[model samples]
Target chain A: NAGVTQTPKFRILKIGQSMTLQCAQDMNHNYMYWYRQDPGMGLKLIYYSVGAGITDKGEVPNGYNVSRSTTEDFPLRLELAAPSQTSVYFCASRGTGGADTQYFGPGTRLTVL
Target chain B: DQQVKQNSPSLSVQEGRISILNCDYTNSMFDYFLWYKKYPAEGPTFLISISSIKDKNEDGRFTVFLNKSAKHLSLHIVPSQPGDSAVYFCAGGKDTGRRALTFGSGTRLQVQP
Candidate 1:
């Protein structure tokens, strides 16, 4: 089964342009997150949603925004993209119970020039 | 300051050898810790984990050990194989309200045959 999926696997944006990274999960998980991984760096949390309509910022949320209109989908919007936003974006979801192992998407690679 | 740190940026090991990746956290409130493995062009996936209440946790060929007093944790891979080569990340978070996992710069592990 396709556990988690992301759209626009690769993207190139010019400065001041905008785009959205789409994510969807079929696990019916209640918690989902958006993270960006820079070269040689760990994944930094950008934003997260506990469930539909509930979202919050995390470690690095300056150049991005997120929305969770439904449990299966979360989209990260890059408004006025900058070179600093060029990185790999990942979406993850996990059950609220059990070992809380997060399942991640294939990731979207964005390059802002 | 980086809350989580992995001093070693990369590690190389011979096949069938043991590979140990270290992680240290400065946050005292972290109740749960996890390890994730990532390959190129993909998102990180769950590997193993340990809770503050438990000193060690094991799953098949991987083991996670936690030292609460020192705020240190480690992932040990026994009999490392070429297929296990990848970037390894350690993440932890407190259950203050949400499970916000803070990640460390990953350690790239390469197993040579």
Candidate 2:
């Protein structure tokens, strides 16, 4: 089974443009997260969802929004792309139980010009 | 400020040697520490983890040592192999109902065979 899948392996966007990064997991996990990694930097959490219909902001949630419509899908939306938002975006999922290991998807690389 | 820190930007080790990756955190509220490994163009994968109550945890060829008083942790990989070369990230989790992770800037590890 595909544990976690992310769409748009690479993308380029102009300033003020908007796009959505698609993420889906087949593991039926209740916890899903969106994170962005800048060059030579660690991943920073953007937004997270504990379950469908519930979403919350994370450390770096300034220019992004998230929606968890179903147990399988959690998409990240960039309202107004900026140069600072050019980074690799990763999606991860984990079970609801205590300290479950997180499974990550192949990241989406976005370049904002 | 970055709560977690990986001071070394990169490390090089010969095949069959030991590779040690260090991480320190400024937050005492973090009760769990984890290590993730990432290759180019791929998302980070969970490698090993240790709880505050445990001083050390071993998984096959990898070992994680945690020093709660020092707010430091390390990953030791014995007999380092060429395939083990990648960026290693240190992450911490604070269990305040939400298992959110804070990551440090990764340390790139190069193993020469």
Candidate 3:
């Protein structure tokens, strides 16, 4: 089964443009997270969802929004993209318990100019 | 401030040799630690994990060692192969209700044949 799937492997956005990164998992995991990885920096959490219909802000949630409409899907939306938003975005899912292993999707690389 | 830190930006090792990657955390409440390996253009994959209650965990050629008193953890790979070349990340989670993880800047390991 496709563990975790992300759409649009690559994208380019102009300043002030907006886009959404799509993520879906077939594992029926209850926890999903969006993270952005910048060069020479660690992965920073952007948003997360514990389950469908519940989403929460993460460490670096300033320019992003997220929605979890179904257990399989949690999408991250970038509003008013800036140069600082250019980074690789990853979607991860994990079981409902604490300290469970997280499975990540092939990331989407976004370049904002 | 970054709660987790990986001081080494990169490491080089000869094939069949041992490789050690280090990581440190500033938060004393972290109870769970994990290591992930990533190839270029791919998502980070789970490698191994250690709980605060334990000092070491091993899987095949990979071993994770946690020193809670020092707030440091390390990943060791024995008989390293060229295929082991990848970026390695260390992540830590607190025992609090949320179980959110904080990751360190990854260390790029290059195993040369």
Fnat of each prediction, in sequence: 0.67, 0.67, 0.65
Task: Provide the DockQ value for model 3.
Answer: 0.73
lDDT of 2 by residue, A1-113 (tens): 98999999999999999999999999989899999999988899899999999999998999999999899999999998999999999999988766677889999999999
DockQ-best of 1 and 3: 3
For B1-113, candidate 1 gives per-residue lDDT tens digits of: 78899999999999999999999999887878999999999889888888889999999889999998898999999989999999999998665565768899999999999
Interface RMSD of each: 1.5, 1.2, 1.4
lDDT of 2 at A13: 99
Number of colliding residue pairs in model 2: 0
Question: Model 2 - which docking category?
Answer: medium
Docking verdict class for candidate 1: medium
- In candidate 2 the C-alpha lDDT for residue A64 amounts to 95
Tell me how far the alpha carbon of residue A42 in candidate 3 is from the true structure, in angstroms, after superposition.
0.6
Query: What's the C-alpha lDDT at position B67 in model 3?
Result: 86
Predicted candidate 2 versus true structure: per-residue lDDT over B19-102, tens digit per residue: 999999999888788999999999889999888789999999999999888888999999899999999999998655557788
lDDT, residue A20, candidate 3: 93
Error of 3 at B21 (Å): 0.4
Q: Score residue A74 of candidate 1 by CA lDDT.
A: 95
